[model samples]
Target: MDTELLKTFLEVSRTRHFGRAAEALYLTQSAVSFRIRQLENQLGVNLFTRHRNNIRLTTAGERLLPYAENLMSIWLTAKKEVSHTSQHNELTIGASSSLWECMLSEWLVALYQQHKDLQFEARISQRKSLVKQLHERQLDLLITTESPKMDEFSSQLLGHFDLALFSAAQKTTKSELKYLRLEWGPDFQQHETGLISNDGVPVLTTSSAQIAYKLLQQLNGCSFLPVEWAKKREGIYLVPDSTTLSRPLYAIWLQNSDKQSTIKELFKTPLIAQ
Candidate 1:
C-alpha cells in the first residue's frame, strides 16, 4: 500500500477538514480529496462521513488509524537505520521536558562526547507521548520517572536527584507564601502529600520545572526545584523545615530492541555525579 495515502488520510483525520489538511500538507484541496478517495477506494470502504461543516472518521477509519501510525513510525525508523553509514550509528532518545531540563541535557553531552561515532536525535515530550512513541519503535531509549509495566520493555534505574522547596520571599510564613507546583512525577506527588497537609491550593501548577522557576523569579512565591538549580540562582532560599525530596530516574527501552547492546553500553556513562 502507498504510505502517502495513509499519510494523507491521517492529516485529514486530524484536521477534520480536507481544505485544512491540504494547507498543512502543502497540497491543493482537490489533491488532498483525491488522496482520500484513492485510499478509500483502495481499501473498499468509506473512511469518512462528510457533513455540511463537520467531518468525522467512520468505524473502519478508527480501526485503521493505529495501524497507519505504526506503519509510518516503522517506515521512518527503517529509513534512519538504512541511511546510517559506517562512520555513524543513529540513535533517538526521548524524555520528558522536565527530565531534559534537570538531567538528560548533561547526560546527552557526556554521551556524545564519549561516543563520537553516534548520531543523536533528542525528543522532549510528555510522558504519555514518549511511552506511545517507545511502543511504536519511534524511540531507541526513553528516560522517565515511571516504569513501563509492559513485558516487552525493560527498565533500569539511572540515578536519583534531589529537589527542595525554595522560596523567593526573604521571610514569609507557610500560609503567607504563594505556592507554585511543578510536577516531578507520581513518586514526588506522594512524597509531597506526606509533607504538606494544608498547604492550600497552589497559585499555579505545571509539568515544566523551568516554568515554575521563572514564575518564582518573577513573583515572590515558593516552589520545589532541583537542589542544583535552586543553589545557582540568587534570592531563592531553601524553605525552612522543608523536607528534601529524592526522586529516582529510569531508562527504558524495548527488551528485544536492535540497539539493545548500544543502549546498555551508553548507560555506563555517568549521568550524574553520585
Candidate 2:
C-alpha cells in the first residue's frame, strides 16, 4: 500500500476540502482526487460522501482512520530507526506551551545536569500536536496534565500543583474582577463552569499561563495560575474566597519504546515535586 495515498486521504479528511488539502500537500486538485479514487478502488468502497460544499467520511472511511494512522506511525518509526546516527543518543520531549513554562523548563535543566552527553530536544506545542508527535514516534516523552487514552501508551504521575486565582488588585469581588481564563484541560474546564458565573465572560482567554500572568499584571485583571508561578511575582495576591485548584501532571511515553530505561531513570530522579 502507498503511504502517499493514505497521507492524501488523511489530509482530505482533515480539511474536508479537496482544494485546501491539495494546497497543503502541494498537489493539484486533480492529483489529490486521483489518489483518493485509487485508494477507493483498492479498498472497493466509497470512502467519502461528497456534496456541493461539504465532504465527510463514510462508515468505511471512519473504520479505516485508526488503522491508517497506526500504519503511518509504524512506517515513520521504522524510517527514523533506519536513519538514526550514532554520534549521540537523542531524545525528544514534547509538552503544551504552559507545561513548558511551568515545569518542563526546570526539568530540562535537571536532565542535562544528570546526563551531559545526551542530546535533547524540547517541543512546545498544543496538546493535539503533542499527541500526534507521540503517535508518530517523533517524540520520546510527553509531559501533560491529562493522560492519553491509547493502550499503547503508558503514563506516570509526576506530581500535582495548585492553581489559584491571582490578581494585581487587592480584595476585589468576583463580579468586579476581569477574569482571564486559562486552559488547563477538561478537568479545569469542568471546575471553571461551576465557579464562573453564567453571565461572566473572560476579559481574555489564553492557553499559556505565562501570557495570562503577564496580562493580569498589565491589565490589573485576575487569572488562575500555578501557585508556584504566583509566588515568584510581586503584588499578585490570591482572590478572596477563591478555591485553589489542583491538577495532576503526567509523564507519558510509548510502551516498549527504545528509551524505556532512560525514561524510567528520569522519573526516578527528584525533578518534579508535589
Off by over 4 Å in 2: 1-78, 85-88
Q: lDDT of each structure?
A: 0.83, 0.84
- For 120-223, candidate 1 gives per-residue lDDT tens digits of 89998878888888887778899988887999999999888888888776656455667787877666677777454375467888878778877885766778
> For residues 143-242, could you state the per-residue lDDT of candidate 2 as single tens digits?
8889989999989988889988888878875566778988887667878865654555788988888888888867767888888877888778888867
- Model 1 scores what on Cα lDDT? 0.83
Which one is best on TM-score?
1
